[model samples]
Structures are given as C-alpha cells and as structure tokens.
Target: MRTRQRWPILVAATLLVAACGQESETPDVDQNAVATTSCASSGELTMWERSGGNKAMVDMLVEAWNTKNPDCKIKLTYIPHTEMVGKIAQGIASGEVPDLMGMDLIYAPQFEKAQQLVDLTDRIKDWPELKTASKGHMTVATFEDRLYGVPLYADVSALFYNKDLFQRAGLDPNKPPTSLPELRAYADKITALGGDVKGYYLPGNCAGCNIFTVGPLMWASGAKIEAANKGDEPLVGDGVKQVLQFTRDMVKAGNVHDGDRAENGETFHLQFGSGKVGMMGTGNFNITLAREQNPKMNFGVALLPGMTAGSSASFIGGDLVVVPKGSKRVADAVNVMKFLLSDDVQVEVYAKALNLTTRSDMVNNKYFQAEPLVQDVAKALEVGRTPYTLTFFEQINSPQGPWLKMLQRAYYSDDSLDTIISDAKKEMKAIADQS
Candidate 1:
C-alpha cells in the first residue's frame, strides 16, 4: 500500500511569504550555549529529499552513513518535487523539521534569512577537503557573510541539440551553434522540416528552469537584473530591455514551443527524446533521460549561445545539505557533511545520480570522461554564476513575475519589442523597490 504524504505547513508559509514579500524572523538561538555543546549521538535524524532519482541518491548516502556509523541512523522522507518547499516549510514551523535537508539553490536565501539554518563556517574553515569539494558553490549557500549549507551537487543549463536534426538541417553535427544568430539560423532550418517539429523547446511554467534558460540569454547580451551598486550610478540600463526583447523575438519566430505549458524538465525530455524538438535549454539530468528513452537518438550538448559579448554564462541551480540551527547533533552533522564532500563519495554519488560534481578534482573522473554530455556540462561550469541575490524566489515570483509572462506574450503576440521591454522594466522597478 502507498503511504499518505504530508505537506510541510512551513513550505506553504514560505511560498506565501515568497510570493507576497512578507518576512519571517528567524528563531533566536543562544550562540554561546550552542557553541559549548559537543555534537550529540544516537538521535534519530530525519532527512527530506525529492522523489525518484534524487531520492535514490539521498538514500544511498544514508545507507553509507548508517553502515559506517552504526550508532546514528537517519529516517528518510521522500517529498514530491512539486510539494518539497511547502512541506519543508511546514516541517520547520511545526518544530518537526528534518535534521538535514537537500534543498535547491533558489530557496537557500529564503531559508538563510529565517535563521532556520546553522552556520557551517567554523566547521568548513578547518576542513580543506570540504572547502575544496564545494567548487565555488559555497557562494550560493552564503547570505550576509554567513555560511549556511554545504553543497551536495551543482548543475547549469546547456543547449542540447539533436545531432541528427542538425545533420538533416544541413549543419555540421559536430559543431553546434555558439551564438544567437547562428542558433536562430540552425533552428529555422530544423523547423523548416515541418510536421509537429519545433526549433526549440523551453518550459513556460517552471520559473526555475526559465532562470537557467532565459537568464543566461540576458547575461550573454550584457544585460542583468540590475547594475551593481558602486556608490550611485545604476549599472542596469538599456541592455535589460534588449535581452527581454530578444526572448520575445524567439517566441514570435515560433522557435519556442507551446508544449512547455504542461510539462517540466522531465516532460520536456520526453518530447525531445521523441525527436519532436531539435534543441532545448536544459540540465544534465536530460542527458540520462534521453539516453534511456531513445538510445539511438543522436544528441550533443553545447553552451547556450552568446550575444554580442561572444561569451555565455548559465545560472547554476542544484541542492545543498544544511543542518538546522537547533539540531543537537552538530558534530555528527559536520562529520556527515565532511564525508559527503570527500572525493570518493563525490565521484560515487555523481556516478549514480548522473548530476554534476562540485569538486574540480571530479571533473575529469572516468565517469564524466565517458559521457560527452557530462563533459559539456563541466565545460559550461567554468563560466557559471549564481543569481546576484538570495531573494531569488521573491524576485521571480513577485509582480515582476509578469516579466516572464510579458516575454511569452511578446513572443506569441504582435506586440512591439520596445513595448514589451518597457512594460517589464516598469514591473521590475516595482519589485526592486520592495526589496
């Protein structure tokens, strides 16, 4: 019999707060007392993770810990992908939160502000291996000068093109398009083949995926959400308008498909696997799914096309493991964190999960060397940058969320590019004011 799933109430609260821009104060901890207590042992720890492949990986980690420690055991909870954030929030609010959690990078900042997380700075300062294993992702897990979590895995978006589609379109399969104009030319060629084929497929519902897909386009074009504050003079100017307009153009050209409305990363993969789409902006997970669904599907991964800058950068998104602020087993938690970061575990877990590793040492491991898709992902990682602020969830879900809608509308409608961008900028300024 299947068990009933309980949604964490705190997650609902988080979603509400994220969407509405409400702030929740972190529970106060007596730092002096917490610092003096040694790590506890033999306590039952609860860990929550998303289902399917991700769940399998967390389970493997738990098993390894249990076999070696014997004294400490973890109870694993599988949360549906759609409900993970809400359930995690519910768990936190009820004081029944998991001892450790595997969370997406987008939610890290929100959790950090709530003081729901324990600072791992002191622990990491002495552990060279853990520091080395983080592969620059620690920056994402940090907020206000405090380290809140240890990265479990890292990933970035890339263009996955069907080699067969490229060849059929009279393009070299070995050399995928590297710039926007080139991509448009190649995609047009693919679409010309007709019959339910689209040049590109990107999800419209998944905002997180959009950050990876569309955000990079803006960055490549020398645009950003805003300019860095170097004592006055705002950095963001007209470039933002230009990038949004470009996305609108892609939509207008029919290069992007409507199928994204009901699908997500997995559904997008199924579509791509069937040869219905020629190119997609997706993550490493798609490589595995594509291989399983159609072993003969000729596909190659490439960095997302560049703009005038002639360079590409992707928004990195993945999971990190953090100990809650009130956990009694801080030492043991640190120990487990260390083990997870070890080279042996990084390669083993990455091999099984097929996710990218955070360590530089693991980039050239035999597993990645054997898979061209993985290798491409590693190459893209070299140019990766996380979103500028931890309020990413709020930034994406707010009234500014209309920017995304505007992009889709501009793409699908006859609206002028300037109108779409001007409207989006107005909305963006409103959201920034709230921050």
Candidate 2:
C-alpha cells in the first residue's frame, strides 16, 4: 500500500492492424507453417510485458511454466509502460510481434482493432473459472464480443472505515452506510469530531482517482459516461450529476480532510493511517498500509454506496495477458494464457502482491476466509469493473480527458454541476462517435 509507484501519463493508442505474412522457419522452429501444421512443435514462446511494479509475479509465472512445460518455453521481456504502446505499434507494423504480451486492459481494444491479437474468444469462455469473472473484467477484455486478453489479477476498491471512529460518532459499527445519502449523513457525524478527525477524504489532484472513488457512485446510481457500443444510448439518468452534487455538498460541509483536495495517492492514504480520518474511499491495499502505520487502528470494509442498496461498484486494476497476432506459436501462447489464469497462479500471485485475485473460486481459499479485509475485498471483486473503453486512455484518463476536466471544473472553478456534466456528456458523446 505504501508502494509509491506512480504511473506516468498514459497515451492514446493508435488503431492497429493485424500482423500479416509469416516469417520463414528458423532453427528450433517447425518448417511447416503453424497455419498449415499444428503448433505443438512451436519452440520458445517469446512474450513482452509491462513492469507494473510487480516484476516478480512475471518472473514466477514464467519460471513455473518453463519448469512444467519443457517443450513450450516462455521468454518474457519487460517494456516500460511509457514505451509499450509505441514499441508494440512499431512491432505490429513491422510484422514481428511477440508470441504473447501483457498490457493494461484499457489499451487491449485498440490493439484488437488492428487485428493484432489472437482471437481468444472461443477458448476463454469455456474456461470454467472465467464464468465467475466480473462483468467489468469480461467487458474490458472483450471487443465486439471477441475476447482478446485474460485478466491476471487486479487491485479492487472498497470502503474502508475506522470502527473506532464509527463508535465515537455514535454510528452503528455493524451497520455502515449503504446508500449515498447515508454516506453524507454518516460522514457528517464523524466530521463533528473537530481536531484532525476528518469524516472522509477523496484524492482530487490524483490522476485516475475518480474511477475508483466517484466512479463507483455513478455506477451504483446506474449511470455510465461512455457507451459500450456505437448507437448505444448515453447513461439514462442524472446519476452522474447526483454523484457530483454529493461531492460538492461534502466539500461545503467540510467533512473532507482539510488538505484532501490537493492530495495524490500517497497523501490520501496517509490521512487514513493517522487513525483520526473516519472513512476513506480507496483500494484494498491501503488496509495493509493503515495497519502498518497504526497497529491499533480498528477498521472495517463495505461496498462503496450507490443511490440504492445492492448497487455498489468498484474499480479493478491490473494487467491482462494477451497473444500477438503474428505469433507462429498460437497453441503454446494460448497455453500460457491458461496457466496465467489458473487458480494456482492467482493464489500464488496474491501471496506476493496482495492484489485481489480476479477468480471467483479463489474466494473459498482459506487465506481469504481467515482474513476479513481480504474476504470483503473478494466480494467487491465479484462485481468490480475496469476503467476500460475503446479510446479509454484519451477520453477518461489522459490529461485532456473529460473525467479530469469535469473534476477540475467542479472543484477549482465556479461551474455548477449541471453545466459541468452537460459539457462532459457532449465530450463523451463526441468520443463515442469517433470510436
């Protein structure tokens, strides 16, 4: 949780075309083309991966696969996130893409459009464990109903509340807020404790902060900013505006931490660590940090409240494993995808990184059963969503994206929620049309 891994600004991916023309067979390669012959004899499987602050996870997976499957060797190379898109684009254009690649889920569709990936749609759904995958995970990995990548693991967001703060505020510790209105009311109660005890904190200056925090409110209110497909209708109601209004009212009420508006990832979590901050909307990893910082801190978890009950949502983060379209070793690459998604990999990876395993079956693991924080987190993962869309990098997360623009207007300017949201809708619609 204290991991200060800051992501540099992500870039918009240029649409890719599939790799064409097969490379001549080399030493250790079968002479018959994989398209003409079975790829069972395919030699070393070369893969490209982004080092998302967890290189060991990649190392462990590759080592495990190589040990067990001697015939299909996996060779992985790390590409910095800032350089991955340009490198992949060049590789695709040159028709020399790797056998498999690991990438952020948001960029998968842009690559898929270029026919730059192996079609995994037929293989992925049949994966019994995948049936338990959250709609958001499945949605992120799919383009035009075709599966393009396998979700490895993801960081999930859930509500973290100090039980001590709840007791002090006279709010029932067993019954946390279940609706957005209740969140404000409960937060106001906790905020009444003046000195250093803030009711809540939402990271404003942080890039991609809203996806896990306010984005869930929009989802719970049954709204989405972007359409999944062209000609699909925009979010039907005023849910987006409602989330904005709730946030604005909280600011006026002074429930948010004093310096919260200026906080990035590090400072935001530090507020919760001080033990006086009553509630925080952040990722599960923060729990580890809170305990490490204050051993006696008694905290609990709940879903991020929506407009109504049973409407909670979460933002899931992590990488997806994919196969490049140019690979002659499709069979072995597909095998690697399976191994990455297998229950064993999910559990082992979680041990090292504490990232929530995306698999539904892993909920039964004894580790989660005994760990209340992780158990609650696993529940959220069952419904967690990715901040993914075609052009997602440009429309939602990049410097000029609408989400950041909307936040700045709502917080730093005199713009009313109505005008801000109306403008956002138009920007989002234009992006959708371009898609």
User: Compared to the true structure, candidate 2 yields what TM-score?
Assistant: 0.86
Cα deviation at 424, candidate 1, in Å, is 2.2
lDDT per residue, candidate 1, 182-237, as tens digits? 77778888988778887887666555556677777776767666321122222255
**1-435, model 2: which lDDT tens digit per residue?**
112333322333432432333332312233232221113564787889876535666677788778777766788899887677777766866767788888766667666766666677765556776787655667778877888877755667788899999999999988878998898999999999788888887776664666667778888798876654456544447788788888888877888865777665556657677887787778777777899999998899988888886679887776777877566766666667677666776776564455566676776776666677887877777667775556565566655567778876776566877888878777766776767
For each candidate, give its TM-score against the true structure.
Answer: 0.82, 0.86
Q: Which 10 consecutive positions of candidate 1 have the poorest summed lDDT? A: 1-10
True-structure RMSD, every candidate: 5.7, 4.3
Off by over 4 Å in 1: 1-40, 50-53, 80-94, 130-136, 204-206, 226-239, 256-266, 388-391, 397-400
Question: Candidate 2: which stretches are off by over 4 Å?
Answer: 1-12, 15-43, 53-56, 70-73, 228-235, 264-271, 348-354, 412-414
